[model samples]
Target: MRGLFIIGRTTAQSIPTMLGIIVISFILLHLMPGDAVDAIVGMSGSASKETVAQLRETYGLDQSLPMQFWNYLSGVFQLNLGTSISYSAPVLDVILERLPATLTLMLCAFVLALAGGIVIGWAMAVFAGRWPDRLLTAGSLLLYSAPNFWVGLMIIVLFSAKLQWFPSSGDESIGAGLTGWAWFLDRAHHLVLPSCALAAFFVAIYARLTRAAMLEVLRQDYIRTARAKGLHPMLIQFRHGLRNALIPVTTVAGLHLGNLLGGAVVVETVFNWPGLGRLTMNALAARDTQVLLGILLLSSVAVILTNLLIDWLVTWLDPRIRS
Candidate 1:
């Protein structure tokens, strides 16, 4: 009951937050120099001034900014996200088509980051103040500092270009018509590189965070008590130390979900993955306001919901918070 109340309250709070995101995104996207008509004209090679004027009027781009926003807000209330000038479809439909791909990529990267970070961080913590810890710390710093795009390109160059290990650019093999495990495996194969690229910095961050958190937890009196109880060192570290240390990591992960989506824009572009991130690039290129706004709104919702979940998880993990 308390959890439900917390969820309800958090969700109620998020309504205004979402509204602000929608307003800000709409305003900022509109303020950009080009509009759907300009992008259409460019795509079509040329258009008469009269044709251009008609295009703007057709898309209601000729309306005043305030009027446009009002109309958009009205449609939003009705669950109509407007139409994508580039796709000639409802913005929601266009986004839905690409949503699964992005979700898959994100899930893969997220899991990889969390699992790998925990393991690596555990090792680092166990080897604290030793050469192993020092080595992992330096490596984490390198990964954290490297640009996602640069790391993506390097992975493509080495794994794709030289070693022929994995396909560098795509979510799946086109026209393979594979079924079941074949299709799943093929998709996973393609996902490996992009997921790694997307997860590199996050892995570094979580690893470092976990290491610090574990170190702190290890210093607590409870950890010393566990040691004095004659518990196995590994069991004490895993069952007691790491479990208590995960609260901060979980919170940070929830907050970083937005940044993960932002990074996906570059990763998808680099990998040519058919996800919202790639779609976002295409929308920006074409000045597709409807699509851009839809993506932004949906992303905000995802982040809000994720944070809500994180709150619940943190509460469950640490009873102190409930008090």
Candidate 2:
């Protein structure tokens, strides 16, 4: 009951924040110079004033801004995101179709990052003040500070172009159907370079955070008590120190997951992955208001949901948070 109440309150608070994001995004997008119809008509200077007006009316661009915003708000409640001016498809349909590929990539990257971080962090923490710890810390910092696009380019050069170990770009081959193990393997193969690029930054941050948190936890009196009682080193670290150390790491990981999805624009474009990021870029270039708005709303909702899930996980991991 208490947990449920907390969750309810959290969700209630999130509503206004989400609304603010939508409002701000809508206003900024509109304020940007140039209209969708103008972009569609192009610079050939052939479109007449009558033709432009007709196009604007057709796309509801002729309506007052407030009225347009109101209609959009109502449409959102009905899950009708309007048709893309550019794609000619329902915005929601286009977004949903691409969502699975993005999610799969993110999930694989998250798992790899988490596992790698824990192992490296644990080792560094256990061997504190040693040369190995210093080396690991230095390597982590170097990777953490590196720009993601730079890392991605390096991966592409090494693995895709030079080594020819994986496909250079795209989610999968043109003819690969979405069924059977062969299809799965092909998709995974294509996913490797992109996922690694995405995971590398997270892995470094997670490892450093975990190492620091574990080191702090290990210094506590309780940890000393566990050690004094003759518990094995592995058991002492895993059974005692790890759970406590994870509170901070979990927070970082949750925030990173939100960032990964929202900021995948560059990485997705680099890999030519047909995800929300790529779609958003194309929409922006074409001034497709419907598609842009849909992507913004979807990304905002994803971040909010991820935060909510993190709250629940934190409450579960540290019971005092429930109160």
Candidate 3:
């Protein structure tokens, strides 16, 4: 019941937040020097002044900014995000087509980073000041310092180009008639590189966060009491130290979802992955305002909902936060 109330309140608060993002994104996109018509005309290589004027009118880009905003807001209320000039489809429909791939990529990356970080961090904490800790810390720093795109390119060059280990580009094999587990395996194979590229930076961040939190929690009075009570070191560390240490790690993970989404743009572009990130880059190049706006709104909602989920997880993990 309390969880439901928290979810409701959080969602209510996020309504204005999403609206603000939508308005700001719309205004900023319009302020840029190009529109969907410009992208279309550019793509065609030439257009007469009259043709350009007609295109603008067709796209309703001829309206005043205020009118445009009003119309867009009204449409938003009705769940009409407008049509994509590039894709020639309803904006929502276009986004939906790409959303599943993006979700899959993000889910894989999130799970890898969170799970890998926690384990690495726990190992580092348990072996503080030892060789394992030093080695892992240095690796974490390297991963954190490296840009995700560069890492992605390197992975492709080494794994795909040199070793012939993984496909360099795409989320799946085109035209493959594989089914059931075979299809799932094929998709997973394509996913490995992109997921690693997207997750590398975040894994480092979570690992460092977890290590610090674990160290702090391990020094607490209860931890000392557990040790004095002759509790097994592994049992105390996992059940007590790690559990308390997770609160801040969970908070940071929630906030980083936005960054993760942003990073996916570069990773997807690098991998030619058919995800929202790749679609976003294409939309930007074409100055497709409708598509851009739709993606932004959806991305914002995703981040918001993810943070809400994180809040629930944190609340469940730490009963004190419930107060």
Candidate 4:
């Protein structure tokens, strides 16, 4: 019941948050210095003034700002995201088409970061203040502060150019005759460089956060009692300390979910991946308002939904928070 209440409350809050996002996006895009109509007309190779006026009318650009926003909000409620001016396709369709690739890359990177971070963090906590911890702390700091794009380029140079291991850019290799598992393997091969580059900074951050969390949990009375009870060190660490430490880490991960999505835009551009991030980049370059707005709205919604899921998981992990 408490969990349901939390969810209900979050859902209610999200409604206003979403509205704000829509209004802000609409106003900013519409109020921007550059004219979307001009952008469209310019792209069409010197369109006549009549054609320009007709295009503006077709896009409802001739409407008053208040009226246009009202129509947009109404369409939003009806699942109408408008049409992409550049692609000549539905904005929602363009985003949906590219979503899977983004999800795949993000998920793969997330899993890698999570696993690597936890393992390294656990090891550091186990050997706190020792040479291993010191060495790893320095390394993590370096990685966490490095530019993701620069890291990606280095990865490509080493793996793609020097050793000739993975594909430099793309989610999958083109023109391959492989199928089934083989095709999947090729895709995974291509995914290696980008995923590693994207995951590196996150791994560094999670590692540090997990290490701090574990240290704090280890100092608790329960952990001391577990140690005094002659429990195996591994058991006490894994079953007791790490489990409790993960609570805060989950919150941190949820907080960073939006950042990860935003980072995907740059990462996807660097890798030339055909995901929503890359699509967003192209849309921005072309000043395609429909596609850009659609991508931003959907991305924001995804982040909200993910945070809600994290809240549920956190509640499940620590029922005391439900109070």
lDDT of 3 by residue, 76-122 (tens): 99999999989899999999999999999999999999999999999
lDDT (tens digit, per residue) of candidate 1 on 152-191? 9999999999999999888789899999999999988999
lDDT of each: 0.93, 0.87, 0.93, 0.86
Candidate 1 TM-score over all chains jointly? 0.98
Ranking by TM-score: 1, 3, 4, 2
Candidate 2, number of clashes: 0
lDDT (tens digit, per residue) of candidate 2 on 193-288? 888888888889889989999999999999999999999988999988998888998888888876787647777888898888798888888888
Q: Which residue runs does candidate 1 get wrong by more than 4 Å? A: none
Each candidate structure's TM-score, on Cα atoms with residue i matched to residue i, is 0.98, 0.95, 0.97, 0.96
Residue 102: error of model 3 in Å? 0.5
